[model samples]
Target: MSKKTVELSFPKLVLIIATTVFSFTSMSNAFYLMSYAAMPWYIVAGLLFFVPYALIVSEFTGNLGQYSGGLYSWIDHSLSQKAAFLTTFLWYSSYTIWLASLFMKLWIPLSILSFGQDLTTRTASFWHIPQIYWLGLGSCILVLIVVFLINKGFFTISRFMLLGGSLIALLFVVMAVSNLILLVNHHGQLSQPMQQHILLNSPNRDYQGLLGNLGFFIFGITAFGGLDTVASLVDRVGHNKRRFPFAILIAAILITVTYLAGIFLWGASANWAAIFTNQKVSLGNAMYFLMFNLGHQLGGVLGLSSAGTLILSQIFLRLTGLVLFWAYIGLIMTIAYAPLKSIITGTPKNFWPHFLTKENKQGIASHAVLGQGLLIIGLIWLVVFSNAHAVNLYNNLTLMTNVSRSIPYLIVAIAFIQFRKQQHDYQLIAPRYANLASGLVITTILSAISFSIILPLFKAHYLESMLLLIGPMIFSIIAVILYHHFNRQIELS
Candidate 1:
C-alpha cells in the first residue's frame, strides 16, 4: 500500500506575533527598567516610540511578503546587496549574543539552587568547586543537545514556547496584582516621597556624567528592541496584512500595562533603596519576593505556586532560546547555500526546478551550516571558559545585541523614506495617518541619536562589546574585498 501523504501549512501569523513579542518582553532588561526607571514615563515613552516603529514595520512587511527575506529583503531591495548582507549579518550576530545572555540567566538560577545561599561567598564550598562554571557548562551542553533535537524537527517546540510565555505572563500579572492588593489592604504607603526631586537624586552623584543615570523609561525603550522579530516572520504569517498590525498593537499594549503594574506594585511594597539594593536583579526574583511577602497573608500555597512558576518559566526560556538559535542557524545555512547551489549545479531559476530547492537537506548547503555551527560552538566555549568575567561578558553581550538589532530598524526607516519619494505611482494600501511622516522622521532621528549615545557605554576591556560593534563592519569589508578579488581571479582563470 502507498503511504499517505500530508501537507503542513505554515503556522498562523498570530502565533508568530505572540511568540515574537513574548521573546522580547521576557528579556531580563524589561524587568531592570521597571526597577530602575520612572514607570509612568516609561509607559508614555513606549507608546510614543514603539507605536510608529510597529506601524512602519507592518506596512513594509505587508508590501513585501515572503519573497523578500523580510528585513534583509527590504534592505536589499531598497538599498544594495552589501547593505542587505550587513543587515542580515548584524541581525544574526545580535541573536547569537541574545542566546548567550539567556543561557547566562538560566545558569544563574541553577547556580543558586545548586550552591544554596552561600553561593554569593567567594570562598564558599561551591566556589572551591567552581559549581557555577560546571553548571554553566552543563547548561551549554544541554542547550546544544536541545538545538540538535530542534533541528531534527520538533515543531511542537514553538507551541510550547508560546505556552510557556503565556504562563510566565500570567505569573507576572498575578504577582503584580497580588502585591498591589497587599499594599492597599495593609495601608502601605510609599517608603519615600514619590516626587520628581526624590527620584532624581543619586547616591553616586555623577549627575552630569555621560552615562547619566538611565531611568526605567530609557531601559523600557531599549528592552523593546526585540519586538522587530515579529516583522521578520511576516512571510511565515497567515493573513499577514490584516492580522500583523493588530498583533503588534495588542502586544505593545500588553507589555506596557504589565510593566506599569510591576513598577507600581514595587513602588508600593519597597523603597527606591530596597529596589536598587536587591541582589535578585531578575524580574522573576522580584516577583517571587513580592509574592512571598503577600502570600503570608493568602497562605503558603500562592507563594509556592509563584516560585514554581518562575522555575518552570526558566526551563521554557531555555528551550525557546535553543529553538530560536537553531532556527536562525537553519536560515543562515539556506541563505548562504542557495546562490552556491545555483552556481555549482547550474540550476536555472524557474518554477519547480528540483527537490534541492524544496527539502531541508537538499536545499540547505552543508558547508554554510558547518561554518555557522562552528561559530556557535566557539561562542558556547567562550561563555564556559570565561566564567571569572561572566557577568561583565553577559552585560556587554546584551548591549551589543541591542545595538545590532537596531541597525535593521534604522535601515528600514531609510528605505521607507526613499520608497515614499521615488515610488509615486505605488499606492499605500493603508492611508497614512496625520503626523505619520513626522513619526518616521522622529524614529529615524532617535535611532541615530540613541546609537551615538549607547556606543560609548561599552567599556574598552569588554571584547564582546568591541566584537559586537566591529565584527559586522569587518565582515562587510572582507566580503567587498573578496567580491573584487574573486572577480579578478575569475578574469585570470
Candidate 2:
C-alpha cells in the first residue's frame, strides 16, 4: 500500500508470467504422458485447449488489471460475490495438495542428482530415520523456505522465477540437442533406432488404458495454467493493457516449442512402453540412460576405456539433474506464493479473518502466507504417518491438485461468458459468441479431464480416493463456515 512500492516493468512481468506457465516438471509430466499416444496428441491439446485457455485467462487478467483480486474480483464484478468466493477458495485450497506434490517433485530430481538412481531401491540416513521419512522432512523445510520468501515480497520472488525459468529452458535445449546428437549417430540405449515411427506413430494401447492416461491430459492442461499467478501483479505490469496479452502470446509459443522439442527428444531416447512401466522414475532414468549410453559409444569411437566413458556420463547426468532441481525449485516457490496472493488479495476483507488480512512491513500477506505453509506442513506430516508408498502418494496428490485447481477455471469460464455478454465496450478482439463458446467448450473439456483423474483414483484404491476427494470438500465446507463467521464479525466490528 506504500506510494513508493516499485511496479513491474514489461520484461519482469513477462518473466513472472512466463515462469508460471513454463513448468519444467509439467513438461516432464507431458513427456511421461506421451507414452500413451503419439506426438500429435500433445499438439492437439496445446492447440485446442492450452492456446484458447491461455488467451481467455489473459483477457480476464488484462481487462481487470485495475483490480486487486485476480479472478475473485473479475468474477465478483461479472457474477455474484458468493461465486467469486467459492472460485478463489477452491483455487487457493488446491495448493495444499500441490505443495505436498511439489516436495515430491523436488525430492525426485534431487535424489537423481545425488544418488544417481531412484531412491526407492536405495536408502539415505537422516537422523537414523528411513529415507521415506526424510522425504516428508525435506518437504517441510521447503514449505518453510517458500513461506519465508513470500513474506519478503514478490519482487524478490520474481527474481527467483526468472532465474529458474531460464535454467529450465536451458535444460530442455541441452537435452534436446544431446538426444538429437545421440540419435543421429545411433549411440543411446534405445531398443530401436530413433526413427520417424517412434516419434510419430501412435502407441498400441487399448481404449481403457488410454482412458486411464486421460489423467495425464489433466496434468498437461494444468501445466499451462498459473497464468492467473500474475493476476495479483496485473497492475504491476507496465502498459499492461497492451503488453499483457502480448506476453501471454509469446509465453504460449515458447512453451509449445519447448514441450515439442523435449517430447521429441524423450520419445527418441526411450521406448514408450518402458517409459510407462517406469513412470515413477521415467525422467531421471531416460536422461541418465541416454547420457550414459551415448558416452559409452563416443568413448569407443575416441579409443577411450569404458570406465572413462561411464565417469563422463555420470558427470553429465549429475549436472543435468542438478540444473533440473534448481529450475523446479523456482517453480515450487512461485506456486507457493502466487496462488495464495491471488486468493488472499482477491477475496474481500469482510470474508477474511483479521489475521489473514494482516500485512508485513514489505506489504506482503504475512499471516496468510504463514497459514498456507502450516497447511502444507500438516499435509506433509499426514503423508508421513499414513505409511503410503511414495509413488502412490505422489500419484494421488497429483490427481487431487489437478481436480481442485480445475474447479476455479470452470468458474472463470462462466464469468468470462457473463462478463462479455454484459460489457459491450470490452477491448478483447474476439466476437462475443466466440469467447462464450470457447469458455463453455474449454470448461467442459477440463471438467471431463478432471473426472478421468478422479474415477481412476476411486477405482484403484477407495481409501486414498476418498481422502483426496473429501479433503477438498472438507476444506470448502470449513471455508464457507468461516466466511459467514468472518463476515458477521466484520459487520459487528
- Report lDDT per candidate: 0.48, 0.65
On residues 262-340, what C-alpha lDDT tens digit does candidate 1 reach at each position?
A: 5556555445455545666444444334333334433332454756655544443343334433333333322222222
Q: Which stretches of candidate 1 lie over 4 Å from their true place?
A: 1-19, 22-37, 110-133, 187-218, 239-242, 278-371, 386-402, 421-472, 478-493
- Superposed Cα deviation of residue 336, candidate 2 (Å): 1.5
Top lDDT hit: 2
Candidate 2, residues 1-493, lDDT tens digits: the string is 2111345566665666676677555555555545424356667667766777677777776677666676788789889877787777777777667777667668766776898765743566667888777777877888888789867876677677777876766766666766676566665444334566544444533322555455555555656677666555665444554567777777778777777766666655556565455545454455555544445544555566878877766766776678778877777777776667667777666457768877888778788888888987887787774655855665665555555676676677777777777654445547755575565546656666456546656468666566656655766786688678767887898
What alpha-carbon RMSD in Å does predicted model 2 have with respect to the real structure?
4.1
Candidate 2 shows a clash count of 1
Please identify model 2 stretches exceeding 4 Å from their true place: 1-15, 28-36, 120-127, 183-216, 238-242, 271-305, 385-401, 424-426, 440-447, 450-473
Clashing pairs in 2: 69-346
Angstrom error of the Cα, residue 412, model 2: value is: 1.1
